[model samples]
Structures are given as C-alpha cells and as structure tokens.
Target chain A: MSALVTGATGFLGRRLVRLLREDGLQVTCLVRPSSDIEPLRQAVGDALWSGVDVRTVELMDENGCREALLGCSVVYHLAAGLSGSTSTLFLNSVIPTRRLMAASVSAGVQRFVLVSSLGVYGTQTLPPGTVLDERSPVDPHPHLRDPYTFSKVVQERVAWDAYKASGLPLVVVRPGVIIGPGRGVLSSRVGLRLGPLMVRMGGGQQLPYTYVDNCAAAVRQAGLAERAEGQVFNVVDDDLPTAKELLRLCRKAGAGVKSAWVPRPLVQPLAGAYEWYHHWSRGQLPGVITRYRTAAMWKPLQYVNDKAKAGLPWRPEVPFDEAFRRSLTIAPAIG
Target chain B: MTTSPSDMIRVALVGCGQIADAHLQEIRKIPSAETVAVCDVHQDFADQAAARFEVPRAFDDMQRMLSEASPDVVHLTTPAHTHCRLATELLQAGVHVYVEKPFTVDVREAEAVLEAAHAEDRSVCLGHDQLFDPSWVQCRAMVQAGAVGDVTHVESVLGYPFSGQFGRQVATDRNHWVRKLPGGLFQNTISHPLYRITEFLTDDRPALHANWFAGSADVSIPTELVAHFRGEQVTGNLLFSTRIEPQRITRVYGTHGALEVDLDAQLVRRSRQNRLPGAFEKLEMPLRHCREATGNLCRNVWRFLKSDIHYFAGMRCLFEEFYASVRSGSPPPIPYEGMLRVTRLMEAMFEQCREREEAGDTAPRHSQERIKVESDHTIKSDQRSNQRPVTTNRDESRELQEAWS
Candidate 1:
C-alpha cells in the first residue's frame, strides 16, 4: 500500500516518514517548494516528492495535493507549525489541516492520521488534580489565545467533522510535550543554557511530557492499526515528572548547568511587568510574557497511553533518562 | 621529606602578575616555605611585590634570582610562551618548578621542560590547584567510591561573560600574551577545569579527539571551544567559552545515578540519606545544604586562617611537595607527562584553526588580537610574514635536543 506524508522535513514528520518506509510502504512526501530537501532525503530515501503549499487551496485546486494523495492508501498529516505561538498555530495548524483533510477526501484516501496536541485542553489555570484525557471537554478560555492550541482544537474538530460527513476513517493522536533527538526547539533555545530558574504557574507541579520517539511510534501505530479508526489516543509516557523533576533530569543528563528557582508568585507579576515594559517601549506586544507564563508551566498534565497500548500494539522502547539524554544532544542553533 | 616548620624551604616567585599574588598568598600560609625573592622581566613589578610581601630580595633576571636567592623551589607564573624556557632554566639549576595551567604554549615546549627536569633528577608540578580544592576532592571521592555508580559520560562547561579584563590587557600593549596566545580562552582559562576533570575521571589518561568552532563575532578573543574525548569506558565533552553569561558547571552521568557540580556555587549534588521530620528518607541533596556554598567555603577557609603566617603555612605544605620532590628525586603530584598531554591537546586545537584558515574557511568571528593593544596597533599582525624564516642554528638545536633527551 502507498502512504503520503506531509511535513516530511519537520521533526515529527521526519520520524513518521522513516517508520512508513521501514514498513515497506510506497511513500510519497508533499513538501513546500522551498523546504530544505537534505533532511528529508536523509530521513526517507528520495521518493516521490511533490511541492505544494498546504495553506494555499490553489495548490489543492490544481490537483497537486490530490495527485500526491491519489494512489496512497493512507495519508499522515504530521506537519504543523510548532513555534509555541498563537498566530503560528492558526496559520499552520488550523488552516493547513483543514486544507489537507479536504484534499485527502478529494483524492479518496482510505485513512487519515491527524497529529494533534494536548494543548487543546487549554487548562491554563488547571487545579492540581486535573488529569487530561480524550474524554475531557474542549474548555479553552476566552483569553486562552494561543494560536497553536486553538488551531489544534479546531483541526481536531475538523477531522471529526470530516469523519462524520464522509466516513473517512480518521485517527486523531494527541501528544504531550514531544522531546527527542535530531531537532527540537526546547533543546536549541531554552535547554542549552540556564537563563532563569522558574517554576510553572503554580510551583511547576503540572505538565506531562512524551518522548518524541514514543510519540512517533504512537502515530505509526495509529496509521497502521485497523482498530484506531475514528478513535483519539492521548500519547504519553507512564512517568509524569513535574517541571522541577525535568530540571533535575536535565542536570542528570549532562546539561552541566545550575538553575536558581524564582518563586511562582514573583514570576507572574515580574513577567507581566516585563511584558508591559517591552510593549510600552517598543509600541508592540512582546511575546516574552507568554513565554514566561508558559515557563511557569504548572498544571499536572498526566495521560494514559493505554488505548494506544491495547489497540495498536505499541510500546515505548526508550526509557525516560535515555530520552532526556537525546533531548540535550541537539543544541539548537540560537542567535 | 621529613623537614619541619623552622627548616623552611626557600622559594622564588616568578612572573609577578595577578596570579602571582594568589600563589604568594598561598605560599605565606605554608610555614615550611618562605618566598625569599621575586623575579620578573619588569623590575618595578618585582621590586614592588618584594617590598609588599616583605621579601628580602628582588631580581629582574630569573637566572640572577636562581643563583643569588638559591631558592629550593621556583614558582613559575610567567605567560604561556615563556613558561618552558624559564622553568627549564630553573630545573637545570637544581630548583623544583611549579608552572601555572597550560604549562606551556605547545607540547614541544612542555616536553622540553619535562626532559630538563628528568635530566636534573628534579620534579615539576603544573599549578592546577582546582584538582586539590576541597569541593572537587569531595566530589571525586564520591565518584571513586561508586556512590554514583560507574560513570558513563561527563560534560564540563566553564564560561563567564566576557569581563574585558584579558581583552583590556590585550588592547593595551601591557600584555600582548593574550593576543598571541593560541586557542584563546580555552587555553588560558578552561584548561584548568578541563585538566581537573580529566584527572578526576580517569585512572589512566584518556585520549582526547576534538572538533572546534569559533563563536560568531570577532572580539579579539575566542567566545567558545568544544572538545570531545573518550576513554575505554567513558566518553565526554568539554565546552569552554567566555561568551556565556552563566556560571560554570560540570556534570557526570553514571549508571545508577548522577553527580553535578556548580562551580560558581561550589555546590555538589548526589543521592544521599536525609533525615526528615517523620521518616528516614533516602534523597538526593546538594552539598552544604545552602544556596551560597562557594562563598561560604571561601569565608570559612579565611576564618580558619587567623593570620598571614597561618595561611602561608598551609600553602607551604603544597609548595614543599614540589621542593622535596626536587631534592629527593621523586615525582611531583601533577607529573610533567600529564602536563605535556594537556599541552598537546591544546596545540591540536590551534592546528585545527590554522587548517580551517588555510582552507579559506570564514575567518573565526572573534579576532584573537582585537582586544589587545598590540593587535589594534599592528593591524593584521597574524597574517603570514614573507620575511625569511629564522633557521635554528646547530647550537640552539643541540641545546633543545639535550633539554628534551
């Protein structure tokens, strides 16, 4: 069977392409015309490569997207802009997925795998005991204006809508903080050096992380396993380490840096003031406040990957320490 | 070796620079040693230091200081380029030598110093006191004891925001050494921590294979140098830079657990037993259990030394080891061979840079000479000179051969 992969140059997309190739499927990659081809060629051998912009329906209209997806038995939509920004989420996640789903339907693709995020829960101020699962309602706050999260929520909704309308056998995978080797923004930007020690919004007790390899394995499983059709799985690891635990783990994994903790109460106000100052001085809103608020990442985001385990026969082979080590090895090029 | 406090070993302080003060301060704390004389190329620096330290003699020439002062030990604190020749001269004259970090600019020079010491049946100790620091000692002990299990890898990073101290020195003609020095910050500062790490981790020395990249700006100094090394069992990476604003840290990854040291804080973390209120808890904890451990340790060490004599007496203990080894024909604590190995590694890094330049690679961002006065005064001084290369005469060649052999 043939499979078409979008965003094959991206961190997750690259991993999915490798898995699909290993499974001996005739793989086709739909890439932007300007995307770097070296990383794609390295991940998946030179295969059928088509250039088309996911955002422009003109490309879809010209049947370029459809042509790529035509012979593919399954389509994996794993490309999403993950800059941790609101606008990027809308442009990359929401709009692109909508376009890709419509094109997949037009091409009569049998199965579609929609890569979603745990951020869609949008519990910015979740209480301590909240455990987010697939059953959790979409309760995004009015002020919860992260474009990426909004897009993921909307994209997942669109996938469900497509599933309802045409019976397009769709599987949605919601992954937590995906970390692994090769390329990750976390390792490149914040992970390489110690800036300021911080706790999540409430003492850094919240947040769950999934190893990148594990997330990829889950996506691979969702794409191939028959039972995963029309189902959503929260793909994460068993261990639920808090932000402080993550810091300790990084140090253990040879980050070779010490962090000084800033009290949670002090962070919010200080971050607000810095944001205000940056905004007033520059006459433009600075994203620093949002970055800092994300830094205060406390909201216990625990998940059970039991559905993936039971239905897809997938298991996370990488232990936490090894995954953490791989996360540090990629030092992102930071200016 | 059995000498007592009253039978003090006479020592000469060479290269009366900033670090010389620290060495002298440490020496004064040693009751078994006395700084009998101070020597420097600059007469004023030597004279002023001798007067301040209350030493009896001062000399502009090191040869004069060695003969006149008859020092049992010579503390070599000169710049990297001059360390070998000066230390060799002192060793040949029957004086034990303690040279500072990156004992020489090149492996050839280091080997010459070792050969001279071996010919004279004396010992040379490179001044890498970080290995002897109490915090490092404790951390090494824990690793040796298998407290953290078998170490698989180690990452060492030493950095500080460019304070412009060395740059300012280079900018002024005061010390052109910083400008001419190879590998810049890595060779000058990071060598200490890197050497200390190698010493701590290995029973047998490891072979270091390194790839280097210059930071993206020409500030007349290097912003970063990264080296990856491996032993039979362990592989490690050393990142040295002056561009990073954060404090220094070193981490060792092991099978069972891990150990991290915050050099700026002088703090260590390892798994240990902790007594909580209700239950006996086995927990991981940082040393000293306080935030400012490094500052606290420094203050405590000062408080322990009630007077200059007390402090100097303690330093003399370290000095006497070099002195007694020279006198009794024993090996120094930090052997000359180990010093040569580190020097060679440093040379290899420079060779990489030259190779890159010859290949027409983009010039490294930081101008090694920019921060120095000499570089500013003489533009493009590093450009290859077309003047006839000075061919070494047979006599000088023979002298070098004799020194190494």
Candidate 2:
C-alpha cells in the first residue's frame, strides 16, 4: 500500500509518516513549499530518512494539490492554518481541504483521514458532571468562534462536503492538545518567564489532552480501520486529568512549576468580562479570561474516547503520566 | 526592601533593548529620580548597560533585581507581546510601569495591565512618543485652539527607508516578533500614525477599509498600506510604506482650515481661505507660504539650540510627565480610556487589512455597525451545534498559553 500525508512536517504528520513506513508501506510526504523540514527530519532519524520521498504543493493550487496525491492509496490531510482572521482560516483550512479531497478522490485514494481538532466543540462548558463523547454533538459556541476554532469547524464541514459529494471515505480525528516531544504548551512558554507556578483557571475542570504519539497512532488507525469511514472520534488520554492534577504533574516533570487553583465562582466574573472584551475587540485581543475557556477548565467532567477505542485498534497505549514524563525528560523546557 | 518617603524615586530599567538607552538617558536627569539598577535577560547586556550608565546594580534576573533594588518605578521597554504578562506582574508588585508602544499586543492585554494597575493602585504609562513630541505638541494645541477649525479628516503617513541594520534585520528575520503580530510590518511601524488619527476621532466603534500592496511582485510581504477609517465624528487615512524616503506627515483637514505637520522636520504649516477676490487669494497664498517657511526655519533652529529636536526628547518629556502623575496622584499621562480607543483603532486597521487579504469573492462583505451585530453564517449546520459549549486547545498548544491569574 502507498500513503501520502499533507502537513508531513508538522508534529503528528512526522509520527504518522514514520508509522506507515514502519508498517512496510511506501510513504510520500506532501509539504508546503516553505515548510520547515527540520522537525520532520528530527522526528524520523537518519536511518528512515533516506527512503522517504518528498513532494511540494501549494494548498490553494487545485492542480498542484491533485498532482501531489498521485499514486497514493491512502491520503492523510493533517495541515491547517492554526492562526489568522476568519477569512485567513477559511482560505488556509477549508479551501485547501476541498482541493485536497477532490484531488484524492480523482487519484482513486481509498481512505482519507482529516486530522481535525477537538476544539470544534468550541469552549465546551458542560454542567458540573457531564461527560463528553462521540455522541456529544460537535457544537462550538458562537461567542467562542475565533478563526482557529471557526476554521476547524468549517474544515470539518468541507471534508464532509467532499465525502458526500465524491464518497471520499473521510474519517475525522479530533485530537486534544497533542503534547509531544520537543513541543509542549506549558514548557515552550519558558522563554516568556511565566515563573514556576501554573494557575488552574476556574479551579480545575477536566482538560481533554492527548499525547502526540497516541494521537498519531489513532490517526494511523483511522486511515486503516474499515469501520472508521464517515466517523469522527475525540482522541484523548485514557485517565482524564483535572486541570489541578495536570499542573501538579507538570511540577513533577522537572519543570519546577507549582499549582494554584482559583475557585470557580471567583473566576467566572473575570472570564465573563474577558468574553465581552474579546467580542468588542472583534476577536483581535484574546483575554486571559474567557467564559468559554473558564467553562472548559471548570466543567468537572472527563472526555470519553470510546468511539476511537471500540472502532479502531488504537488505544491509549502510553499513559498520560508516562508519556508526559518521557517527553519532559527528553527536553524539559522544549517539551 | 523599602524606600524612605524623602528619598528619590528609585527606578530600575528592564529589557536593555534599543529603547532602554533612551529611558536611561532621560531617567537620570529627573531630580527626584535615581537609577538604582538595570536588568535584561542577557547578563552582558545588563552589566554593560549598568556600567555604561553608571548605575549601582545589574542583574539578569527580574525578581532578584526587584527584590534587591526595591525600585518604585520599572521601565518596561520590552517588545509589545511581553507587555501584558510583565506589566501585570510589575503592577502586582506595586511598582509604577512605563511600557513601550503599541502598549500591549491587543486590547485585552492592555486591559489586563490596566486592571492590574487599578487593582494594585499603580501607575502605567504608554510610550506614545508622538503625544509628547514638541512639534506634535504644538500641532495638537493648535488643533485644540481651532487653528484647523472642526477637524473632519486626517491623513497620517510615514515613509521608511529600509537601508539600515535594524531595517535589514526586520526585512530578513522571519522569527521577528513584528512578523508574528497580526499586521506584520504595519504592526511594527504604524502605531504612531494610528494614534495620530485615533486621537482626533471619538471612541465609537469605527468602520474601517484597509488595503495593502507590496513594493514588487517578488516581495510578498506588504510594504505599503492605506487604511481608510470612519469614526463617529471624523474620518482618516493611515498610510505606511517602506519604499519611500523617511518622513512622518500628519495632515488634518477641517471646515475652516488645514494643518500639515512634518514630524521629522519638526514643522507645522497651516492654510486658510483668503476670503478675498480670486487674484488676491492667489497673492495671499504665496505670502502665507513664505511666512510659514520662515517660521518653520526659526522654530527648527530654536528647538535645536534648546536640544528639543534630538531623538527621544519626546520620550524624555513623556517620562517626566509620567513621573509628575506618579508623584501628584493625578490621572495617567496617557488616559486609560483614550489608550483603549487607540488600541481599538489600531486593531481595527489590522483587521481590515487581514480581512481584505483572506476574504475572497464569496465571503460576505464585512458590514460596519456599532457593538454586537449578530454575526450571520453562510454555512448551515445542525441547530443543536449552535448550542454547543466552547471547547479550546484542539490542535494548537501555542495559543493555549495561560495568562497568569
């Protein structure tokens, strides 16, 4: 079998490419013309590097996108513009997906996996004890519609659009914040001198976090699993950690960061003020507090990743604690 | 560490960048001010700055400097992005803060600092140098005095010559903080012009139309922009370009007259209708021009003699005013409300530019209205999805950095 991956230079793309190669399949990497290939090379060391084939395509160029998917039986689209205004998000994400999907369908690709984000749910502020699962509608709050989330929502729509139009056999994997080697939310902020204490917004709700390798494995499985076609899975850790516990673990990971949680009641008003400001600013200025982010961090619930577990062979093989520990051990600040 | 009430206002400088030297140069001249320490992330920069400026202490660590120096004021001359976190931290520590421009990266960050300052009852000064520039001060006074009648429109333009080392750095460095900002080149350089026009406009939600173009087909990064704006009572255009000779010109058009300010030359020219016969009007214009030319020369020479025309002199004046407010318990040198208004305008301009770039033929034209127009959607989804709660941090860890509560 042959596999082609867009966003092959990104965090997950690198791992998935290696996974395919390890499975003894020919893998081709389709990257943007100017993408930094260093991370990809670092992810797959020298031995596997020589056999890898590379192709460059402009996402917006329909012909180029089509040409890039040639000779691949399975196509994985993992690239999306993570930032910019609403229009920028649409251009970078939705438009590219449409072009890529059309191209993949024409090239007779059997499976297409869209590496979507769990953020498509917007800032999910469920009731205190509500657990979210695949049955939970992929709903995003109106007020929480920044370009990043809005783009993801639209990109998923585009993928489904292609699926319905061309029967492209699309599977979407909405991964949580993918904590991986040489990259981490908490630690990359070291340069900002955030100091050694992490504050839990809204006194500790469940954060839907997934380690990078687990997410990659799930994505690889999504492409291979016959049952995953036309399905969406929320890829997250097995033992969902509370915001408070996560920070405590962060401290133990040689980060030397401690934890402080502000009671939910006290933080709610501040988050509301920030939401108002974000709208008034027209999504230009992001506030430290957002009602959406506050709700997510204080929801007092865990995410259920049952769909991916049941339908696909991929499980949370690496526990969050071990994965996190190993990641920090390799690169304390970078990860 | 503590300070006596009778002692000079202890001050420490942070982030020994290009602007830190300006603060150090001016800060030392204040009678009640004492430059107790200087600090930077780089030790050599801190040590060299402290030694060069004859400061008594130097430290690479911020907390240690704050702990050891116990300075009443900390000048934050760091990049725009760092303002929110660092300023909030300083404000919590109960130190007066003087931050360099664009104030904070966005309005919320600006509000964050203000909230912290209000919470701690500390002072925060924005490094809006034009607000204190001698030529700008004179022009502003004239505008207030009706030298330009009822101001209706403004054209604020700045030209940059990308020929210097710093210019080359901005041109080449892909990882530059300016490149990371929303407006890219405009974010780095357009604050002055944005504030110039924003000052003349009201705080009502503005309607903006901005378009940008690069110098050549090979240059993809925008080096030129035209931001047309409509506020409640005024309209303005902010023009910026790197292809032109260096000049800062802010012209105000009014019902009765016009005021043209040359910021680089420290000159202001005013024009009014002669209200005479046609031939007499033609004669009056040149006479007015000649008189204005002589006045400009005189003003320039006088300012040079008095050292008011030197670089960063406005910064010095602004700092002195900030100190006055800190000592007298008065309103901030830059009104918090006005600063917000300026930030709004700046962000609006960036939004317009980005909107034009990404918005193609299909997207609905951005409508201009006041607060909270219900955003209409083009793509339909299940109605249940509308009620879905907000979920963040899907694929992006970079945007998930928590602002310390």
Candidate number of the best TM-score: 2
For every model in order, the TM-score on chain A comes to: 0.80, 0.88
Report the Cα interface RMSD of each model, rounded to 1 decimal: 28.3, 20.6
Per-prediction count of colliding residue pairs? 29, 6
RMSD of 1: 26.1
- Write model 1 residue lDDT over B1-405, tens digit each, in one string: 555655677888888776676677667655567889999875545754575467899899988888888988888888777888888888999988888776888877888888898898777888766665545666789889997788888888877555554433343322356557776556677676677556645534466555445455445444566777777887778886656865667888788777777655555776434545433332223433454456556654563443211212323455656666755667787765567666766687667755665675524433333223333332343335522222255554444334334
Candidates in order have lDDT scores of 0.65, 0.74
Per-candidate interface DockQ score: 0.01, 0.01
Worst 10 residues of 1 chain A by lDDT: A51-60
- What TM-score do all the candidates reach, one by one? 0.44, 0.49
